[model samples]
Target chain A: MTYCVAMNLAEGLVFVSDSRTNAGVDNIATFRKLHIFGTPGERLVVLQTAGNLATSQSVISLLRQRLDGEEANLHNVDSLFEAARLVGSTLQEVVEHDCGNVQRQGVDLGCSVLLGGQIGEEQPRLFNIYPQGNFIEATRDTPYFQIGESKYGKPILDRALNHATPLEQALRCALISFDSTIRSNLSVGMPLDLLVYHAGSLEVPQGFRVKEGDAYFEGIRAQWCSGLRQLLGELPAPPGDYWS
Target chain B: MTYCVAMNLAEGLVFVSDSRTNAGVDNIATFRKLHIFGTPGERLVVLQTAGNLATSQSVISLLRQRLDGEEANLHNVDSLFEAARLVGSTLQEVVEHDCGNVQRQGVDLGCSVLLGGQIGEEQPRLFNIYPQGNFIEATRDTPYFQIGESKYGKPILDRALNHATPLEQALRCALISFDSTIRSNLSVGMPLDLLVYHAGSLEVPQGFRVKEGDAYFEGIRAQWCSGLRQLLGELPAPPGDYWS
Candidate 1:
């Protein structure tokens, strides 16, 4: 399992993803799920994936392999929408290639992807690409997309994030969301990959890789936990009459 | 879908459940999921259910119907453990009776139950009964059980709840959990049914049914939302160096 969240905010785009994947409890391993594509200062496209590891890896390899070919790829795509379509189609191609043999063994070959970044002069956009070669772009009303192990971390995003949120604040909220998910679910673990893309930069910014005991991540976790407990304690308890 | 949570805390037991049930988005309706049983001053038991509404309703109806029969019933159970077994078996019976026909149409007939209360001189106990007629009791290390639409509301409970948490605080936490679920999931909604039992009382206490305009519940919602926003703001944002 994986948890990847990306937000297309007013100031920029924020992406956070956990690095753990497991075939089973005993077969746990770390796999990087965040992939950066496109040419620096020309087009910046980020892809975060979840679901079947084999399918995602294959899709990523195919996307990278096609970059030097004549066919459209993440690098040469005219817009984020076209880039999303290419990713979606590549995912579909990979699944279809392995799905027949995989389905006979009752294994799922589906994968979900979050594609977000700037392409040339267009504004930053985010898209959630499903396994069936289809996608939906994020809009102002719903400016974020999350894939895999999403529910445990969704409440904070629902409560705190919006299109107009500053890039830094959105990054913080995304980290807290990951913290909540990692606490409740063992399938999702650190080290985490975080990227904050300033709109129109068309260049990947300096991303942070939060490993175990990383001071900033640790501080945020401690502060968030203690702060939540404090907030709950301060909230008025139900009236005595309501109990009786 | 439904959201019901029960906690066995030091002070006593707390149960909170949403009332909405839906066959589909267009078929939404209200049905109480909380049921009170056992004789006052002798034994007190409460059941909160989620899953197929028909199956839960049938299980509840059968439990009530058997109360007057010679067979053992909730009112006649020797202990809360016995009561949990009885509920579990009754649920299994209901599901088995309808499963063959219902499953032929590809509909699910499973339901989950949370049973908690006291009997005679024994301490209060909580049980999470599965559809297979098996159950697990809550322990000091894990004193709560949530059924249906649980993930969206789980982080706060994981952060703030413990066996040592006071009954009032546990109740408050349960309500907030329900609020989070309702906000994120369309399947779970109000009005909510809440019951708080004081340990050793051995009698059913007055339970609160919170409706849409209920002032206390509205206050909690307002306070929790604003308080969470304030808390997020006060927490330091990730350092600028992380983003570059």
Candidate 2:
């Protein structure tokens, strides 16, 4: 299990992902799910993955593996859409290669990715790529995509995120969403990888690698807890014989 | 799908349930999930059901029919635990009678209940009854149980609830939990039935019916949204280039 989220806002794109993976409670380990690809000013795309670790990592490696000589790649993709296509193609290839063996062992090749960033003159964009290698781009009406352990955290995003939100504000929303996921699920843990890309900046974006004890995340956790209690305290109790 | 939560708190107990029932998105209807028995000072036992509506309704009907007999029934149970046993026994009876027919169509029997209340000198108690008729009492550590569409609302309870929490405060927590569930899931909707019981108080517990226009709920919803944003605003942003 994992929790990864990416948002495309007016100011930029925001990506947040947790770094915990477990086969069983005793087999827990840290694995960064966010993969970054860039050529500085030319392009900057990030892929946040969830589902079967082997499949996701295989897809990522296939996406980055050199294809002989000069050929289309995330590094040289002309548009964000093309970059998404490259990811989709890679996912399909990886699934085709691995699904047969996985099926023999009674495992399903389940994997998905949140792909987002900018390339050349194209506007910042985001997409959710499914296991079948098909994808859906984020639209103005729905400006974010989340993969894995999504339900626990979805309410915060449903209420808070929009296409016009500022970069920092979107970051805040993503963290709250992550906070919700972490509390309800053991599969999503600390050492978060977050990226905030300013639209059109093109160059490598600013972000954080948030480990446990990271001051900012600790503050967010404590404040959210306190704020929820405070807000709940302010709500009016039911009137006379309300439950009678 | 449904969302029903019951809490065993220091003050007593609280149970809230959404009434919407859906076989699919196109097939949805209103059906009350809370069942109340007895009057003030006699004994008050409330049952909140979630999961397969037919199975739950069957259990309810069975319990009701038992009440029509001259001997034992929910109203005549000597204690809250005995009332829970009656509910569980009734559920098993319904399953025995209907499960074979239901499973023939490839649908498994599924239903659960949050049974809570006071009877005579026995302190107020709450139990989460499973589909198999087995159940577990809420403890001081956890103190609450939610069934169906639970993940979206679980974090609120994880962060806000405890056995030491006052009944009013716990009620607010339950509402916040319900609010989150309603926001994320179409299957869980209003109007909500909220019941609160005071510890050792052998009186008819208070009940609050929250319709769409319910002012307190509206205020809580708005305040929670704003409070979450405010809390997020207060957290420090992650450091630049930490992900590089």
Candidate 3:
């Protein structure tokens, strides 16, 4: 299980991904799901994946292999959409190669990716690529995309995010969303990879590896919990009418 | 799609369910999902259903018909476990009768029930009954059960609920959970039915119908959105050491 989220906001983009992967409860392992591709001051593309770790890793390696070729890469993609297209095409190639054989063994070839970043002069953008290689771009009304264990973290995003949200605030909300998920699900754990891009910057944006006990994340988690309890205590309750 | 949650807390039991049912987004209707069976001073049993509306309705009707008969109804069951068995048996009966036929047409015979209440001298209890007729009782560690579209509403409960939680506060948490679901998914919606039971009080537990515009609900919803925004503003920014 994994929980990865990426948001496209007015100030820029925010991406967060959990690191825990498991075949079952007893076989958990850490696998960083965020992959960064770019040249400083040129272009930055962040890919966050969730689902089968093997499939996601393969997609990443394939993309890197493509980068090593004498052709288009994250550094040279003509547009953000084309970068997303390259991702979709790579995912499709992997699926076609393994899905049928995996299914015969009762295994699923499942993986989804969140591709978000800036390319040259294009605005920062985000796309959620499905297992089938189909994808959807984020729009102003829905400025974020999430994959894997998404629901637990979704309410906060639904209520707090918008196209006009500042990049810093979006990063805060994204972290909070991940905090909510890790607390509620044992399968999703620490050592988060987060990236924030400044729109049109075309460079490696500020990023972090949020491990457990990281002071800032710990503070946000504690404050968010306390704030929720305080909010709950302060909400007006149904009159004694309902309980009497 | 539906959202029904029931919790067994120190003060008593709390059950809340949304009323929306739809064949598709274009065709939606309201139907109560909370069913109560009791003899005013002797017992109070609340059943909340989610999943296939037809299956749930059939199970409810079967239970009602059993009550109409003089011997095997919930009213005659000596223990809460027995009552749960009765509900599970009814669910099994419905599944056996229609599940195969339904599957032939591409639909599943999906349904789940959250059964909670007191019977005779037994204390209040809650059980989550699956479609296959198996059930699991809520424990101190797992003090609540939610059925159907549960994810969106889960974070609040995972954070705030515990066995020691008071009935009123637990009920508030449950409502906020439902509010999150309703805001995120059209399949889950309004006119929620809520039942809160006091420990050792077998008959006629406190209850209410929380509809759109219901004063207290409206207040809480308004306050939650406001509180979330305020919290977002209050959270500290990314540390300057890492964020530019």
Q: How many pairs collide in each candidate, listed in order?
A: 0, 7, 0
Could you tell me the C-alpha RMSD of candidate 1 in Å? 1.1
- Candidate number with the higher lDDT (1 or 3): 1
RMSD of 2: 2.1
Ranking by DockQ: 1, 3, 2
Q: How good is the docking of model 1, as DockQ?
A: 0.71
**Which sequence of candidate numbers ranks them by lDDT, best first?**
1, 3, 2
> Residues B1-244, candidate 1, lDDT per residue (tens digit)?
8999999999899999999999989999999999998788998899999999899999999999999988999988889999999999899889889987878999989899999999999999999999888999999999999999999999999999999998888888888888888888999999999899999998797688989978888898888888888877877878767785
Alpha carbon lDDT at B4, candidate 2: 92
Model 2, position A166: C-alpha lDDT score? 80
Query: Model 2: clashing residue pairs?
Result: A242-B207, A242-B208, A243-B206, A243-B207, A243-B208, A244-B206, A244-B207
What are the per-residue Cα lDDT tens digits for candidate 3 across B1-244? Answer: 8899999888889989999998989889999999988987688888999888899999999898878687778888888898889999899889889967777888878789999888777778899999888899999999999999998888889888999987778988998999999998999999999888888866585578887888889889989999988998899988964453
Q: If scored against the real structure, what TM-score would every candidate get? A: 0.98, 0.94, 0.96
Over 4 Å off in model 3, which ranges?
Answer: B241-244
What pairs collide in candidate 1? Answer: none
DockQ per model, Cα: 0.71, 0.61, 0.63
> What lDDT does each candidate get?
0.91, 0.85, 0.87
| Predicted structure 2: lDDT | 0.85
Q: How many backbone clashes does candidate 3 have?
A: 0
Of the candidates shown, which would achieve the greatest lDDT relative to the real structure? 1
Sorted into a CAPRI-style docking class, model 3 comes out as medium
